[model samples]
Target: MIFEKFGKKRESAPPHQATPTDDSVSISRRNFLKKTGLFISGAVVGEHESEKFLKKIFKVPSAEVSPKEAVKIMPHKEKHVSAHSPEALSEPSPEVSTETSKESSPLDAYSFLDGQIHPVAIPTGELAGNTFSDLYAMYLGMPNGTVVPETLHVDFKENLATLWRKKFNLPARSHDERVEREQLQFLEEHHNLMNLAEYVYRSYDAKSPNTMTLEEYRNDVVGAVEKSRKVFVDTLPLVPTSASEDGVFSKDKISLISKMGESLTADTLMSLSFTELMPLDKGSANAQVFGFLLRNAGVDFIDRIPSVYDMLESFGPYQITPDALSPKSAGSWATQVLSALPLGFMPWNVDELLRGKENIAAYTLAMLNIAQFIGTRNSAQLKCLSEVMHTLPSTQRAKAVLSFVAAAHHRPHEAYDAFDAFIWSMYVERAHSFREEDILRHIPTKDLREYTGKALANYRFLASGASVNNST
Candidate 1:
C-alpha cells in the first residue's frame, strides 16, 4: 500500500465518481499533472524544454483517456500471486512475480551488460519474479519478493545492497551546514530511497528496449519517503504509535502503517494499494526500516510507481487518500480533528494530510488516526473493527485495523459497508444465497467479504511469515 492511498469515507455512503474508461474525453498531460499537484521541479523542466522533458509520464495511452484511466490499466486488473501468501497466489504477470535465481544468470541480463563488468551473482527471490528483484538483477544488474514482503525485503537488501547504499548529498530542504551535521541521522535514514529510485530508472534505461520509465520517479518516490520522513520525524512526538498503546508517538512505541501492493488479492482491485502494519523494535535504525516498509508497501520499484492514474486517486507511498482533503468529507475530517487533538496535532498538521504539503507524514497520521478510530474498543459505528479485533490475537489487531483502513482506502466506506453486511450475515438466512440487492451493497463486489477475509488472512501471513515470502 506504500500505505497506498485510494479510498476513505465517514459513513457507508460512497463518494460519487465516474467509472473510469480507457477510451473517452482526454485531458492534456500538463493540465492533468497540474491538477494532481505533482508538477514539481520547475528547474528540471525549465522555460524552453518540450513537455517530453517531463519524464513523470510513462506511456500515454494513444487514445488518451482521463487521468483516472491510468489507474485502471496496470495492476488495477492484475491478480495476486496467490490466494495464500502475498506471493503465493496464482501466477503473477512475469514482471511482478518472484523467480528463483538461475544459479548462473546470463551475463546478458541487460543491454548495458558487458564482459569487463560481470553480472554479479546476487541473491534473488525463491519464487518466480517481481520488479524489485528484476530491477536488482539489473541494479548492479542481479535479480526480488516474498508476498510475505519480508522475504522480499530480507533478500532485497542482500540482492540490491548496491542500490540500498545510494544516498543523497543532502536532504531536500537542507538547513545550515552545521545543522546538517546534526541531521546526520536523517541523512543516513531517508536519503537512499530516492537515490535507489534513480538507479531503478537507470537500470531500465540500460534495458534492451526499455518499455517504460517514470522520469518523475524521483519526485514521486521522494514525495513518498524523503519529504514524508522529515515531517514524520519532526512530528514523531505528536503522533500515536498504535491504537493499543496510549497516544504516544515515541521511539519505544513505533506505530507502523504499511501499504504493500503484494498484499493485494484477486477481488481487491489490483489497481488499489493494500496496507498492513508489522511492528519492529525502535532503535537508531527505526525510521530507516519504516522507510523501507513505506517504500515497498506501495510501489517498490520503477514500474509500479504511482502513475498519472494515481494523481487523483491517491498520492505518495502512503497512498494519500483524497477524503482527508476533500471538502465534502467534512464529517470524516471533523472526526479526525477531534480524535487527533489528544495527540497534539495542530490545525496545519491535520490539514497536511489532504493538502499534499507533507506527503508521508500526513498520510501516516491520517491512516493512523483512522486506524485508531476503527480500532477503538467500543465504537458502535465501527463494530466491524471491534468484531474483527475480538477474533484476532492481541498482536494481530493492529494489522486488522490497518487492513480495514486499506480496504476502505480504495472505495469509500467499503470496509464499513462490508462489516455491516458481515454483521447482518450473522442474522441473515444461511441458505445457499439470497437476493443480491438485499444482501449486497451493489458496490458490485458481491464477494466483498471474501476480499476482506483474504486481506485479513494475507496480512496475517505477512506478520507470521507463515508461507515464507508470500509465495506458493
Candidate 2:
C-alpha cells in the first residue's frame, strides 16, 4: 500500500527474448555504454570548438601582426628622389666628364644643373622597423594603434564570452545568453507558487524575532489560506484537467498546498504550546486569542467546546476520576481511538485532550460516547459539522472529524451542542440551506432534545409530532 502511494510498481519487466544469460546482460551493458560514450564525447567536442571559435573572432592574435608585415603594409609613397633635375644629370648621373655634351644643345640652352626631387613626404630606409612602434605609440600612445591593455585574463568561460562580446560591440543575443534567459524564464514560471509558499512558511517560521509578531504570523497564515483558496477557485475556469491553460496554479500547487498546511499546523501547534506555558488564570488572554481565531475562521466546534463541558456535567459527575490506568497505556489507547475516527471530529478531540492533563484514554472514551449520543439527538448539527470537515485543509480536515469521536463520549450535553453546531455550520456554509428532513434522517426521535424543553427547542415542532405519533 505504501509503495502504491509512491506510484511504485512491484512487477518486473517480462523476460527479454531468450538468450544466453551472460550474452543478454552483456548486450544491454554494451548498448548503454555506447550511448553514454557518444553523448560525453559530443559534449567535449562542442565545448572545444566553442572556445576556439570565440578566440578567433575576438582577434586577440590580430594585434600581434609581424613587424615585416606592418612595414609592407605601411601606407606611404615610394621615393621619386632627384627626379626634378636637368635631364642629363637625372638621366644617369651622366658620367660624361660632367656634362660634356651637356646635351650641349639643350644644356647650353638650359645650363643643366643637378637638382633634388621631393614629392610629398615618404620614408626612404628602415623607418619600417619603427613604423609599428611609432604607430603603436601614436594610437596606443602611438599613431594608428589602439589604447588597449596588453592582456586580459578570464577564469570562467562566461566571463570570457561576456568580455569578448563587449569588445566586439556585439548585441546581447548570443546563444549562451539566450539560453540562460530562457532557463531563467522557465524556472520563474515553474516554481513561482512553490517558491512563494516556501518563502511564506519560512518567513513565518523563522527563529529570528525580527521576522514577525504574533499578529503578523496569524495574518500570514490567513493570507496563505486565502491565496490557496483563490487558486482553487480560479481552477474552476480551466477545463477540469487543464491547469496549464487556466493559469489557476503552477504544476507545483500540490507541493505548495502541502507545505502551506505543514507550516500552518506547526505554527498553530506552537501557539497551543504557548498557551500551555501560560500561568493557569493567565490563560484568559490565550482564550481570547483562540476566540478571535474561531470567530475569524468558519468552523463551529471552536464555539461549542465550553458548551460541551457544561452539558457533560448536566447528566452526571463528568470529572476526570483517574482510575487504574498507566499514562503510556492511556496515551496508546487514545492514539488508537483517535486514529480510527473520521476526519470531521478529530481536531475537536485533540483540542479537548490537550486542553487538560487528565487520564487521556478515560476522558477520550467518555467524550466519544457523549458525542455519539448527542450526534444522534442533533443530527442536523452532525451533518453541518461533516460539511465543515470536508472543506478544511486536508490534514486538519480529516483529523478534525476524528477528534469528535472522543468528544462525543466524554461530554454528552456539551458534546451534543458543540457537535450539532458544527454540523449546522457545515451545512449552511457548504450547502447554502439546511432542510429539517435531513436533520431527522440522522437524529432518532428517541433522543430528540426538544422533549427536554428549551434545551432542544430548535426541533420542537418535530418533537411534538413525533410524540403524538408514538401515542397514537
- Candidate that scores best on lDDT: 1
RMSD of 2: 38.2
Per-candidate TM-scores read: 0.33, 0.18
Summed backbone clashes in each candidate are 52, 50
How many times do residue backbones clash in model 2? 50
- Per-residue lDDT over 302-373 for candidate 1, one digit per residue giving the tens place of the 0 to 100 score: 222222222122223343333343212222333333344424332222123332343344344444334343
TM-score of 2: 0.18
Model 2 global lDDT (CA atoms, 0 to 1): 0.26
> How accurate locally, in lDDT, is each candidate?
0.30, 0.26
| Native-to-model Cα distance after best TM-score fit, residue 275 in candidate 1, in Å | 6.9
| Residue runs of model 1 more than 4 Å from their true location after superposition | 1-304, 307-316, 321-403, 424-454, 466-472
